[model samples]
Structure formats: C-alpha cells, structure tokens
Target chain A: MSDALYHDAILALAKDRRHAGRLDAPTHSHTSDNPLCGDRVTIDIERASDGTVRRIGHFVRGCVLCQAAAAALAASVEGRGPAAFAAAESALARVLAGQNDPENGVWAAFLPVARHTSRLDCVRLPLVAAKPVFEA
Target chain B: MTQALRSQFPILTPSLAYLDSAATAQMPLAVLDAVRAFETSSRANVKRGVHRLAEAATDAYAAARSDVAAYLGVPPSEIVFTSGCTAALNLVAHSFGALMKPGDAVLLSALEHHSNLVPWQMLAARSGIELRFLDVDAEGRIDLSALETKLDARVKLVSLAHVSNVTGSVLDVASVVATAAKVGARVLLDGAQRAPHGPLDLKTLGVDFYAFGGHKVFAPHGVGVLWARRELLDAMPPFLGGGEMIAQVELAHSTWAAAPAKFEAGTPPIGAAIGLGAACRWLGTLPWAEIAATEARLCQRLLDGLAATPGVRVLGPQSLQARAPVVSFALEGTHPHDICQIMDSAGVALRGGHHCAQPLHKRFDLAGTTRASLALYSDDSDIDAFFAGLSKVRKILL
Candidate 1:
C-alpha cells in the first residue's frame, strides 16, 4: 500500500530536480510553510508581458511528495497563463479530494497521496506557494 | 512478563509496535476501568454541593490528589491538578512569574520543548523580565557547564526539562539544584518525559516545582500534576480565578482559597484527575528496578541498531548511562515524514518532525528527526519490528 505512494515515477520526479532552484530576477516569488511539520516550498516565476509563466523554479525543504509535486507543477506550468495554471491546480485538487480518478493525468503519480489525507497538504504545498503569483 | 504486561493494554495489537510513548502512552485496562467507574457512578461537581454524589466526587478527587502526592513523595495539599503539563507550566509562568520584577531572569535550556520555552517567552513579553537560555552540547544534552555563567542573584528561576523529549537525556538534577540553591533561585522541572519511566521522589530530587501530564503516564488526557513546595505554593498567587477558589465574594473584591484550591478555578477535570491518581496507584505496583533493566536493554539495542544503519545519526546521548528509552535519529538525505510514513506501513508506529523541540533541531542543522520512544509494555518484538521497518524505510525513502 505504501509502495503506491512512493512509486518510481514520483521518486524520479523528485530526484530529477530539473526545476528545483531559484530564477534570477523572477517576476513573482512566494514561499509557504506547513507549520505542522516545518516543511517549506518556495516558488519563483518569471512571467511574460501577457501574464503567462515564461520560466518557473521551485525550492523545497520538505518530504518527497512535496518535492515531487513542486517538480511536476514546475514542469507543467511552462509557457502557461494564469487560467491554465488555475485549471491544472483544480485538476490536482480534484485528485487530492478524491472527486477525480487518480489515473487521470499529470497528477496521477500522487494517487496514493489521496488516501493519506494528512499528506494532502504535502502534495499541495507547492501549488499553494505558486497560487499567489497567478492571483497577483 | 512482557506478554503479561502487554495483555493489560487493550489497544496493543499483536502486529502493532506502538513506539510513540513520549507523545502519549497506551492506557491500561485498570486506568480505563477506574475512569469508567468514576463517570458512571460518582458523577457530580466537587467542592461545593452537599448532596451524596458531590460528597463521593469530592472524596474521590481528594483521594486522587493523595495518590498523586504519594507517588511524588509530597504532601497532598501541595498537588495542583491542571488540564495538562502545558497548562501546569503556564500556571507557574503566570502565577510565580507575577512575583518577578522587570530585568529578573529565568534560565532555561536550548533542549526545552515549546511548552517549557513559550511560557517563559510569554512571561518575558508580559513583564519586562529577561529570558536566558543554556546552550545544548554536541550530543543534545543541556550544557550544565554554562549554568554558572547564566545564573546570578538576578536570576529568580531555573526551569528545564527533566528529560529531553527529543534526546531522552536525563538532566543532572543534583548539579542543577545545587547550583541554583547558591543563587537563591527556584527550579521547575518539566517531568512530562520522566514520569512515565517510573515513580519519582520529587522531594528527594529537590526541585521546587515539577509538572507532568497524565496522558503520557497511561492515564486519561485533560489531567496533569503540578507539585510545588508548600512555601512556594503559598507565596504564589492564584493562576485562574472563579468559583471554588474563593473564600468570600464581594462586589469590589474576593478573598482567595488556600494553595491547591486557589489555583483550581471553577470545576476541574474530575474524572481525568481520578484516572491520574489511579494511574499512580497502578504504577506503584510495578517492580521499577526490573522494568529499568528491560528498558535499558531495549534502549541499548535500539542505539546499536541505529548505529549500524548507514547515514543514521542519533540526536541524543549515544549510551544508556543516564538516558531513557526514547530514541531519535536523523537519516541523511531523507526527510523524517517519509521515513515515518514508510515505517507506518510495516505496522511500526514512529513519530517524526521536531518533537516540539525545534530549537534543538535547528542547532543540529536539520528540519526534523524520526523518534521511537519505549514504554514499560514495549517488548523485543517492538524493537524487531523497528529494525525491520527501518530496512523498508531505507529502501523506500533513502
């Protein structure tokens, strides 16, 4: 059962760390923390003139699920505007809320996380950190 | 003996190794039965009503106080029951802290849990009192060598943990008390960790005030013991004010009751308090020397196991010389939450994160650690499951 949570895909995504640093002079940056466990996620974005995310990076000082979610989010949000980001965010939310199928899309690797409700925040922390950029 | 002891706790399943006793212990049937008997039979508000139920409730409450006091080797009147250890510490910070003037210092240590640390911070904020902290050593024990430098006539209190919730290092109480006595300072020990190991003779330990939670002692929650010296209790003001703590009420002012009653405002947690007392009585029946030997053996086994694990660094004392069975270790390149999650899948319960001692974690330059604490009921199977789960934790998380 626990193997499903730490599947190869999620582990590889976290270990990849392709987008796991800061962007120089990013347009919008936000850092959020889960005080319960002291897990922190920072999202830095450089947006285009049309308010689309041109370059994005994340730095996570947290669990594998948090790192994996941030990596997945950063990978998906490239060249995407706020509306697209919101849709992606809603898709992940539905998966976490168990309202949507876990085998659906980019967020499918986190299917096991939906069962562990306590860790839903671990998967969503990156999105929470990035939400401010889209909102602003 | 382990199986016999294990049978007393209904929640201990054959497959489960509940190793989080530092957070809370599994209550025995004796305690549960005692609580059930109280709630179902003698249920009423204590200290005021003259009815039959009230008398029984009051008598039970008093008996509980006596049991707790006997366990601590103190006078019954000196015991003040609070909601929990946090509440008890807060009571001291509010009541005894009221006596302190601006610039007066209270010496705490870096290893204190937020419960012991925050109350002093609040005291400092409310009054202009100064808060001085002793540094933690390389092994996470409080650096008592720094005590002399921190203590002076201006230091009115020296409050610290009797045992580190994260490290399980027992404080050198004699050294601390002797040093504090020279400076005429009062000492308060947060006994939340030590109380579960065995009975404590606080009178002999010479700490002026000691506090512990019932939930950590195999009793119900919402109840705790605050045992202070008689003279200090008399000198301190009431923490909370309301019914039962008053002698005479007037529009302008009200006279306060004495000692324990003065601190206990309104209706207390009568049933939980009774359970706490019953827990003390139950603990008294155990053979502590034999239990200590078992715990030490388990502690050494855990230490040896973690020592052999690659990338595992223990956060506390390496040996069982003066430590309890609580063990915390940091796994390099892995988060504690992931380790705990993987271990939980193997039916091995572990606690991760800062263990409410964030400063200690920060000192060690880590975010958190995975902790496995042992109780009297813990057996060899628990330790076996621990190493087994660690193998999986390494494979899964590391």
Candidate 2:
C-alpha cells in the first residue's frame, strides 16, 4: 500500500467503526505501558476454536499515534487464522519500520500505522498479546 | 567587580534571553576556565600525594569545599560533597536508617519531590518507622496547620523541600524548622530547587541538614553538597568507608576521620567541585535582587496570561506572591504531552509530564500538567512568546 492510501485508510478506520471487523468472539485482554509518556494500550484478542486469532481489538489510552495504531491493528487481522496471524505480525513489523508491503501473504491492515515508527509498538499491542496463543 | 565578573563568564551576551536559569543556569566563563585550567595545568590525586601537582590538586579541592560552605552560610566542617542532590538525600536516608530504631516516625510534607520522599520511605520500610505526610492546601502550599497536628514526640525526622519543584511554592523554612524543633526531630531541607534562585543561609534557616545540586546552579554536573550540623555529622556513622575516610585500620578494628572527610570516602569530583565554587562566586556578583524581581515579573505575566486564556487551568497559587517562576497548567480536554509537542513545534520549550512529583498530581487528582519555568534572564518577550504559542496550541488542539 502507498503512504497516502495507508494514511487515508487509517484515518477513515479511526473515524468509522463499521470498517473495524466484527467483535463477535470472546475476548481476553491485557495492557502494556510506555513509561516515558505514561501511554498505555489494552489489547483484546478473540481466538478461534483451534486457538487461531479470529480477531484482534485494542483500546488505546494514549496519544494520537497510539490510537491510530490500535484502530489500524483491529482492522488488519479480522479474518486471519493462526498462519495468517503470523504473516500479519511480520507485516506489522515491516510496516512499523516504514515498509508498506505485506510479507508472507498477509495484507497490510496496519499500513497507516507504519508511517510512524515510534508508535509501532502501540499498533502491535494486539499482535503482541496474541503471540502466546499462536506459540502454544 | 561587575566588569571583571562579566568578562569572566562568556554567556553574558546581549542577544540570548537566558531565562531558563531556574532549570539550569548558564555556566560562567570562570567555571569553564577553572575546569579547563585544572584539566590542563594541574591534574593529580588529592589528599595522598606529596608532590607539587598533587599538593595543588588537594588544595584546590579543599578550597572548593570551603567556598561551598561559605556560599551556603555553613562552616567548612559541615559540608559533605556528594554526587548530586539525589545522592545526598540517599546518604542521609541510609545513614539515618542505620541509627533509627523501630517505632520511630518520619514526617514529610506533601510538596516534597520524589527524591525527598522515596528515601524516607525506604528508611521507614527498613527501620519500621511510621511515615506520615503533611497535606497541602488548594493553593498547593503545604498545610502547616495539618503539619502541627501530625508532628509529635515519636517523629524522629522531618524531610521537606525548601521549594516545591512543581508548584514553585517557597516553603516557610523558619516555621518548619521551629515545628521540628519542638519535637526534637532532625530536619532535612532539599535545596536543589532553591539554591539556584537566591542566597541560602543555613545558620539562620536552622535546618539540621540541607542538600543541593551543582548542575542546577551554573556549575558542572556530578557535584552536590550535603550540609549537616557538626554534632549530627559526628553522631551519624560513616555512609561510605574506603581508603581516605578512615583514620586508622587494624585487623580487629578501624577508626574514621572527622565529619566531612568521613563521608567522602574515595577520590571525589575534583574538577566539578572547583567549577561549582567558581559558579558560586560568579553568582554572588550578579544582581540577585534584580534577578529575583525580573523572574517574579515574568512569572506574574505568565500567570496572568495563562489565567486569561480560555480553557487553561493554572495549577498552583493564582498569584506570584509566594511562588517561584515555575507555572504549571492544564488545558481543557487536552493531554499535556500533546501540548508539549505543539509548543515545541512553536519553538517554545516547556516540560509536560508528572514533573517527577506524581504524589502531588495524585493529591490534586490530575493525570499530568504542562509546566513553563522561568529563570533570571527571562523577560517580557519570553512570556509573550509562550502565551502566543499556547494560544496557537489551544486553537489547534482544542
């Protein structure tokens, strides 16, 4: 995705909740903090029966970049299973480093978030929290 | 003396506003010269050497100590040089922990910085001494009425800051000292924020101990002074033991040196101390009354402007009567970090966070606040620029 496309997508995603994937699954949650600014993001994950990520949701309690990241992450991993979740994680990492392309067949849901590398961690909150489920 | 003094400090240029003196004063040319002179002319270990270079180094270090004592209005025997104010407070806490028994109490004010509060908390935890905090009024001034009610015979020590780093409240040290005196509890006044602003007369202040850092007062970093009464210093056991602090050492027992020497165990920050002394002398020559008045005016302007601005809630006292030049505030429905980022974009520097006083924030039920602190060199333009930038930020953010 291009930078403008990603920015527009993220901005639109932030403004409209319909673009955010269905929050249908039972969600377990956790929060992480950025001590420097006291910014925190609470990660909520919805897992499939086979322990794959059905959906990822996040409520960011921090800055604008962080809020954008959280909203973008929610839109990215809506229908992905376990392998797709891994691919999305790798894509999120690359996007955080200013790379817009999706790696390992995962489309960039968090492309707008990749523009701000400093806020990459905020966008990756759900993915970070869901990693343990995939690993097990 | 003014011309000679101005020539000695290179930062006395006409263009720079240099109003951030309260945050960190500009280093005088004398301090820089002393540092360079020490590094280039004579560099050697102190107290143990007999050669010419060593003698000069030792003399320079001792002279710096004497200068600091004189500057703080304490005797040379009472000043113990440490790394910084945090280190000085830690030393007192650790040493007092060694002396304090169970069932004792440590009283502290709500306006204290974390550096002052954490040490006492650690001491209380280790010694089982109950820790109590004196409250603050709505104006962010320490409630001395509450302090009187809380202080009692069981209180062993009362640690407070001479000035509130966040609210810029100038604590009435005389009243605090008298209250502590009634209970015979030792008092430790953290002068880290106050020492740079004006004269510190320890003899008249009557506090048992005072601590301040060098970097905040136009001196080099890694240098601070902890001034304690001579008898108190003698009574407390040595904080750090090493080669120099000891008088004699045998297989079975060891004896320690006198008050200040006993606390300074290893090779000290010789260059930094010399720089601090030069800075002190340089500061002594400046028009302190003029500086104080200028800072007060700037503070008033800032408070007035901020108060006039819609959606801006000034945090401390409404007036600049008893406060320093530091002003903290919160804009309606805006995070402090965002305000800081916007202000930075406008070329207006300010600090936005807990200001290292989280308890004060918690007491006031606030998450954080944006603070703009002023110094001696600050003037009308700086305050105007700040207000203009703040107006822009409010328009953009709110």
Candidate 3:
C-alpha cells in the first residue's frame, strides 16, 4: 500500500470509536514501548462466543504509527473467525515487511497502509493483544 | 587554545567535523600510545599475583586512580573506578539506598538524564521513599527559587546533573551544594556532561558524590570515576561483592577492603583506566582558557545562525552566559527526525530526540528537538557547515 492509502485507512478506522467496544469476548492486552522514540501502544483483543475474533482495539499513547497500527488491526479483523483473523494478522505482517500488497482482495481497503512497515506493530498491536484470548 | 590543543589529537586530520564529544571525545595520541605501550610490553591482573607484571599493572592502576583524583581535586582515597558514569551513579543509588527508611524523600532536578534518574526511581519504589522533582524555568534553567522552597529537612539526597544533556544549561553547583548542606542532605552531581567544559574542584563544589564518564573527556569508554567524601565512601556498603574487594572470604563471613577497592569488585578495566589517566594528563597540557574562549565564540555563532533561520526556535537560555556549546532547536512545521535526516544527507551530523530526558522535553511541550553539541575540537568551519546544511533544509521545506 502507498503511504497515503495506509494513512487514510488507519485514520478512517480511528474516526469510528464504536468498533473498539466489542470487548465482552475473552480479552487479552499487552503494551510495547520504544524508548528510542518514546512510542507506546497497548493492544486489546476480543474473541467472540464462536471462538472467532470479534474485534481488535488499541488505546495507544505514542507516535502516528502506533495510532495507525491500532486502527488498521481493528478495521481488518472485525467479525472474522480465528482462521481469517490469523490470515489477516499474517497479511498485516507481510504488508509491513514489504512482502505482500495489502490493497488486494479483502485487504484492498487496507492497501493504502501497506507502505508503512516501520509502524506495522502499531497497526497490529491489537491483534497481539487478542492472541491469548483466541489461543486460550 | 583550540589550534594548539588540536595538534595533540591526530584524529583531527580527517575532514569529519566531530561535534558529538558529549557522546565521546576523540582520544589524544598520548592516551593511544600509553594503551599500546601497556598492551605491547607487559599485561597482568593487579592485586592478584606477586610477579613483576602484576606489580607493574598494579602500579599503573594505582597511578591512574591518583591522577583522576588530582584532576577532579579530590583525595586519591575517595576516587572509586567503575565501568562508566552510569555505573558510578548506580553505585551511589544502590549503596546509599541501604541508609534510607520509609517516607524519606530523594529530590532530583527536572533535567536529569535517565542514567541519573532511573536508579533513584527504582530505589524510591523499593524503599517506599518519596521521589520529588526540582522544577525548571522557561529557559530550562533549574528553578532555584522553587528548589530552595522544595528542599526540606525530610529530603535525604539531592541528585542533579551539573549540566543538562539536552539544553546544555550549567547548574550553579555551589548554590545547589549549599542548599543541600542546609538540609543536611547528601548531594550527588552527575558530571558526565560538565567534566569536559567546566572547571571542577570537589573542595569548592562541596558535593558529597560526583560521577563522570571517561569517554566524555577524550578517554576510552568502560572507565569512569565516582568521587565521594571519604566518610561517605567508608560508611557506604559495597555495591558488588567479588575477588579484589574482599580481604578474606569465608563460607559464612567475609571482610571487605577499603572504599575504592570495595566498590571495584571484579577485574577492572585496567588498560582503559591507564588511557583515561593519560587523557587527563594530555588535557592538562592544553591551554584551557583558549579552548573555552574558542568554544564560546563558536557557540554564539551557531546560536545566532540558527536564530536567523525562519521558523526555528532555539531551546535553553538565549544568552551563552552560563551555558555550554550544545544547542537544540526545532522548526515550526518540521519534525526533529526529518530535520536530522535532511542534515545527515547533507553530511552534517546532529542528534535528534529527547536526548534521554523525557520529562524535560515534556516540560518544553515538544516530542524532540535537533541538537548540535560542540567540544574543544569544533571550529568556525564546523559552524559554517552546519549553517549551510540548515539553509539547504530551509529551502527544501519552504
């Protein structure tokens, strides 16, 4: 994804706060800090009643990448089952690693965000936070 | 002073303008030769063997200790060598934390580097002591008025940096020491940033403990000095327990040696210590007044040039009266990282970040700023190069 596309997708997700509320499912959260830039992000993941990922949300207090990452994760995996959720997580990683194009298929809307791999963790923190809930 | 002193450092031959001396100063040939001579001729561990090599190593280490002591104007007995300033400050926090009780307070300035702040913060958490901050003024100077009011009898220790790493604002050590003295509080000065530029005399400064890294003074890394009062050193327990520090080790009980030895537990950085001693001696040979004058001139030139640039705001005191050669600035619409990137591409090296002083950055309402710090080796041409790079950045951004 191009930088503009990535930024737009992340910003769009951030504008919708309702998606961050699906926390009744088994939840797990974790925070990672980058001391070099004072960037910190806390990701919260919720697995639904069907053992699918209902929502991935993050409350981050850091750089733009962190905010974008949280938004990207929340937007990508809503209502998806565990399998699709894992695929999305891997897809996000691939996008950040400059390996795969996020703008393709179901991830087409997220393609704009694929160019910013430097902040992929910021985009995927919510998935990390929700991983334990899905695994357990 | 700089021209005469520049001749001593052969590394000056390169086209590279090294302005990051606060990170690490370039070593003089004297120090390099000393290390080579020691490693090439004879090398042995001190205070362990009875052989001739051991004797020579021990003598060299001991001589280095005395040299550091004399350089800092402290007694040789009070100087304890550690890996660097971080270790020295840690030793103070760890060793002295044993003396504090619950509810006691440790006061620190707002501009302390993480090395000086985190150790005390950990101690505060573990010992249930209150950690307080001495406020800073608008220009990044320590708020002396607030410091006077906040320093009370309940405060056990008052630790602060002699010069701020980010703003390069020099604290009035005499006033700070006197204030702490009034409260009967122990004071530790983090001299890592000040040792290269300022005049240091422990007797005049009257701080109980002072720590500085060798790397900031044209010496090797992995060597530093922790200068404490004789009484304080004698009273504090050893930070680490190991071979050289122990007089006798029993299965149940062990007796440790004196101040310097007790603090240095394992095999010390022998060659590094010797190189530091030689660096100090070499620095002594330079005309300090000339170096200081030249640096002050360069600092003014840099500050004036930066201020002239549109949208640029220089941090810290506008006047160079009590500040060092370090200058931090931010452009209105440009991020510090972007500024640094542009400057780096133009071959003008500079630092861009909070400089490990997050609280201070927050105080100034900034994420980070681009910093250009200078040393004795910096000249007019360096300042010109920096300004030229800034001009390029301005043209691109505008």
Ranking by lDDT: 1, 3, 2
Is model 2 an incorrect, acceptable, medium or high docking prediction? Answer: incorrect
- Against the native complex, each candidate's DockQ, computed on alpha carbons, is 0.73, 0.19, 0.14
lDDT of each: 0.92, 0.74, 0.77
lDDT, candidate 2, B245-298, per-residue tens: 999999988999988989998988889998988877777777888778777877
Q: List the residue pairs that clash in candidate 3.
A: A5-A112, A6-A112, A6-A113, A69-A122, A69-A123, A103-A108, A103-A111
Candidate 2 residues lying further than 4 Å off, grouped into runs, are A1-26, A52-59, A78-136, B1-23, B251-253
Writing each residue's lDDT as its tens digit, candidate 3 over B1-398 gives 56666777887764556666777888888898988887777588988899999999889999988888878887889999999999999999999887888888899988889998999989988989889898889888888887778788889899999988888899988888888889899989999989988457888888889999998988889999899999988889899999799888999989999878999999999999999888777776677788888889999998888778889888888889889888888888665644554565566677777888899898898777888888888887778778877786665543
Model 1 ranges with Cα > 4 A deviation: A101-104
Q: Give one digit per residue, the lDDT tens place, for model 1 in B80-119.
A: 9999999999999999999999999999999999999999
Fnat for model 2 comes to 0.07
Which candidate do you rate higher for DockQ, 2 or 3?
2
Which of the numbered candidates is closest to the native, going by highest DockQ?
A: 1
Q: What is the lDDT of residue B334 in candidate 1?
A: 94
Evaluate model 3: give its TM-score.
0.81
